[model samples]
Target: MSLTRSQVESIAHLARLDISEAELPVYADSLSKILSFVEQLSAADTSSVEPMAHPLDGESQRLRADEVSETDRHEKYQANAPSVTDALYLVPRVIE
Candidate 1:
């Protein structure tokens, strides 16, 4: 699980990061330790374990009614705006 200097450089490039020469060795060592720890975690026996959506058991996520309870007020709201066109608010062009 040891990472070389070149591997660290490649990883940095893929992640779009700018790593200095002095920081390369530090990143390489840290990444190597993280990969080694993940390897150790994968070796654990999970055959008897049951997969769960959450950590706690016998508890379901609370859900509210999916039906809409409010009436549409777009036109009412647009009346207060300075400018609106095609159901979209128009601000002064600032980029051009």
Candidate 2:
């Protein structure tokens, strides 16, 4: 799971990342350690574990009732438009 300096450079190129000569070895070591940790996690046993939608499955989420809190003011705002029709703003056509 360890990554080489050349592999890190290739990854940086594919991801469009700018890595200086001094930082390439640092990035390579960090990426190699991360891959090793992921490999270690993949070796765990989870066959008896049940899938869950939420961590707090017994608790119910309290939500506020959906209601209109603001009045419609389209007519007042449309008064400033240079051109409008049927509550819709008119714009110049750019394409044929």
Top candidate by lDDT: 1
Query: Taking the tens digit of each residue's C-alpha lDDT, what string does model 1 give over 1-96?
Result: 999999999999999999999999999999999999889777879999977678767676778899998899999999999999987999989799
Positional deviation of 83 in candidate 2, in angstroms?
32
Candidate 2's C-alpha lDDT? Answer: 0.91
For model 2, how does the per-residue alpha-carbon lDDT over 12-80 read when each residue is reduced to its tens digit? 999999999999999999999899888876677988988777879878777778988879999999999
lDDT of 1 at 81: 91
Clashing pairs in 2: none
| TM-scores for all predictions | 0.47, 0.45
Give the Å shift of residue 92 in candidate 2.
31
- Going through the candidates in order, what is the number of backbone clashes in each? 0, 0
TM-score of 1: 0.47
**The best candidate in terms of TM-score:** 1
